[model samples]
Target: MFDYFIAPFSDYTFMSRALWGCLVLSLSATPIGVFLTLRKMSLSGDAMAHAILPGAAVGFLVSGLSIFAMTIGGIVAGCIVALLSGMVARHSRAEEDSSLAAFYLLSLAVGVLIISSKGSNVDLLHVLFGSTLALNNEALLLLSGIASITLLVLAIIYRALVLECVDPAFFKSVSRFGAVAHYLFLLLVVLNLVAGFHALGTLMSVGLMILPAAISRFWSNRLGVIISLSFVFAAISCYLGLLLSYHYEFATSPAIVLVLGLFYIASIILVKQCGSFLMKRASLAKLSIEQPIQNPSSIHKGQSNV
Candidate 1:
């Protein structure tokens, strides 16, 4: 057990770094994910994930994979796309989801083209899938910094965020910070996506952000518990995924996401089964009560006939 689970981190520097990076990521990303899920913006997280690609790709082209360059470029691109999507949805005929979908698709294509033009298939793959095992001091610092900034900002905006999720119209009516919270939340999403891009790539980063939240919904309904559970789920997935990758030589990012996917599937199955069981019990109880009442009525009717 120790060799299988503990040895990897203890024996290998890269494994330890990967684990630390993933934990830090889960710290910030999972809560944002919970809020996104609450707001019914889960797909928006995915859209923004792809939307960051062009920026990261541009950074790659300019700086040849410098983490800072790609990160800045990705943040800038993600913010622009997010702002444009919101603006278009508000000011134009297209709805927010439609507009977001359109922008993400275009951003994805443009990003792929830019990366392919300047870099090899390997580089493109790195930008899409991430370099989990190759994280160094710079990448670690970036992840930590993003997580810290995200948590602090989230704390400051906690009330407004909750209000926005619970009742956007009401929040806007009562609080001047409604729009500020929305935009700031979007910024946080972009920031986390950019941070995840460094480790999980544009395609897979949102997995870290969204999947655990999805799983947590199966276990709890309270917002605080759900957020806490999500972080745990994400952390466990990261450990198991990294272990699988280390043992089987599977791609790290996909392995992590695959574990989360398995958890989601299991949660769905378990919830359905429990629900079915509860319904069956309720039905049986109802039938028993009804049967007794019917017997008493039949006895009364027969007595009257006699």
Candidate 2:
């Protein structure tokens, strides 16, 4: 069992890159994911992952296998889609969800169409499903660079982001920092989303983005604890997924994603039980206190009921 788990590590280069990518991806995504889930923008993460396609297609058409070109295209497309959806939601009198659904689905179709029309030389399938084991040096660098930038930006904006998240009205009334921070946050997310596409593909990337964070929410009421736990959970899922995929000859990205999904389900059940237990304990304590007050007459009469 240990051998199987350690097998991937036997290849110093291949597994090293994968593990590094996974760590960066988990670190960048988990805290951001916590915010996204709390903001009800979980679907937006999914949507942005898919929306990166058109940009990727265009990049591949021009630059072929250049990860730099591909990343640029993905970030551009993601930002446009996010901004457009926001604009449509604000101006068209349309529901936010409806607008998001339309833009996200349309972007995906358009990406496929562009890829189809341009040429068939590329394996566009991998973009949708990811090829984690095949990640080259360039991909590792991209993941590293993006992760560093995202973390730095997130650190700078954490307080403001928290403020906006908790008190948007108060923030809006006082400073423009919230507005700037919001867009910057989205930009970092899109950048990371592009990197994640290489590691987990669009379909599974959303799970990594939101699932661990969602599960972490159950164990922590404090933002810092939830964020930390989320990162830990994501890291474990990545390693487990890689080990399982290698052992079972499974696709790495999907395997990792499925592990995260399993973790999320387990968390749901466990968290609910924990919550119920806390609530029950509180109720029992309240009842214990109230009993003495309600039965003052019994106390005065020396009537003790067990």
Candidate 3:
């Protein structure tokens, strides 16, 4: 167990860095993910993930993979797309989901075109799938900083967000800051996606943001517990996925996402089974209660007939 799990981090600096980076990412991204799931904006998180690509690609073209450049570019691009989607949904006949889908598809194509036009396939792969094992100090700092900002902002907007999820009409009526919280939450989503872009790439970053939240829903109903469980799920997935990647030479980003996928599948299966069992027990109990009452009625009827 030590050699398999503990040795990798101890023997390799990169492994340790990767683990730390992923843990920090889970800190901020998972809670936001819970809120995303709550708001039924899970797919919106995915759309914004792809939405950051063109900006990152542009930054790559300009700075040749400088973390700061790509990050800034991705954040700018993601924010623009998110804001545009929101505006179109409010101002036009088009709904938010359809508009977001259109923008993300276009953004993805434009990003791939830009990257392929200027850089090689390797650069494109890095932008799409991420380079998790190659994280340096700069990348670590960026992840940490983003996590800090995300957590602080989430704390500030916590109440509005809860109200927004629970009752949007009431939230709007009660607080003028509803729009502010909504937009700020969107901004945080973009920031985290940008941060995730550095480690998991545009394609896979949202996995870290969304999957654990999805899994946590199976286990808990309370918001606080769900958020806590999501972080734990994400952290465990990262550690195990990194180990798999280190030992088997799998792509780190996909491995991590795949592990999360496994957890999600397991959660679904377990929850379904538990629900079925509970329903069966309830039905049995109901039948037993009704059977005794019917038996007593039959006895009373027979006595009356006699």
Candidate 4:
């Protein structure tokens, strides 16, 4: 039981790299996911995932098996899809979701068509879901670069992201950088999705991005609490999933994603009931409450008789 679980930890270069690669990605993606879900941009994650197919396929066609260059190409392509769909929706009264869905579906179809024309269906296996055991230095670098970019973008736009997530109209008035901030977040999502696809597969990457954050919300209402909990869960899922996959001989990316989804569901039921407030502080605060003052009453009956 402990053998496959702990075996990868003992010795293995690629496995160690894979561990770091996913942990970093989970750190960025999990927090962004909470924003996406809160903003009802959940579908946007799916749209971005589907939209990457074509770029990845095209990259494979041109670069053979260079996952680095190919994934960059895919990330760029997905960003294009995000920007264009947004532009179309904003320029006209047409809905962003409607436009996004169309673009995503089209991209998915085009990707399949391109992959079909280039070669056999063998690439589809790796494309749809990744093979983590096969991770190379190139894959590690790509994931790291995307994670770094995501964190930077978030830092610059953290307040705006929060405002937009809670109230877009208020965000527009208060933040001078609201529009830029919005697109930037979308851009980060595309990049993160592209990077995470290798570890979560095309279909499951969105879940990996969204689930852990959603799970973390059950335990706290503070934005900081949710974000911190999300990052921890993401890291845990990534490490444990990799360890479990190696031991069980299961697929790595999906296994990691599966563990995340499990945590999401588990938190939904369990964390909702945990209620972990600081007891000492709460007790002290309760003891310091002041009573409300009462207005003086007049003896109207006696005054009238006098």
Winner by TM-score between candidate 2 and candidate 1: 1
TM-score of each: 0.92, 0.91, 0.93, 0.84
Q: What ranking emerges by TM-score with the best candidate at the front?
A: 3, 1, 2, 4
Q: Over the stretch 219-267, how does candidate 4's per-residue lDDT look in tens digits? A: 7789888889888888888888888777787788878878988887887
Encode model 1's per-residue lDDT on 158-254: one tens digit a residue: 9999998888889888889988999999999999999998888889999999999999999998989999999999999999999999999999999
Which 10-residue span in candidate 4 carries the lowest summed lDDT?
Answer: 290-299
Best by lDDT: 1
Instruction: Give the candidate number with the greatest TM-score.
Output: 3
- The segments of candidate 2 whose C-alpha lies over 4 angstroms from its true place after superposition are 118-122, 279-306
Candidate rank order under lDDT: 1, 3, 2, 4
- Enumerate residue pairs that collide in model 4: 4-247
Q: Please provide, for model 2 over 30-126, each residue's C-alpha lDDT reduced to its tens digit, 9 standing for 90 to 100.
A: 8888989887888888888888888987887898757888789998999999999899999999987788888889989988887777766346677
Q: Relative to the unseen true structure, what is the C-alpha lDDT of residue 283 in candidate 1, on a scale of 0 to 100?
A: 96
Total clashing pairs for each candidate = 0, 0, 0, 1
Model 4, residue 39: displacement in angstroms?
1.3
lDDT comparing candidate 4 with the true structure: 0.81
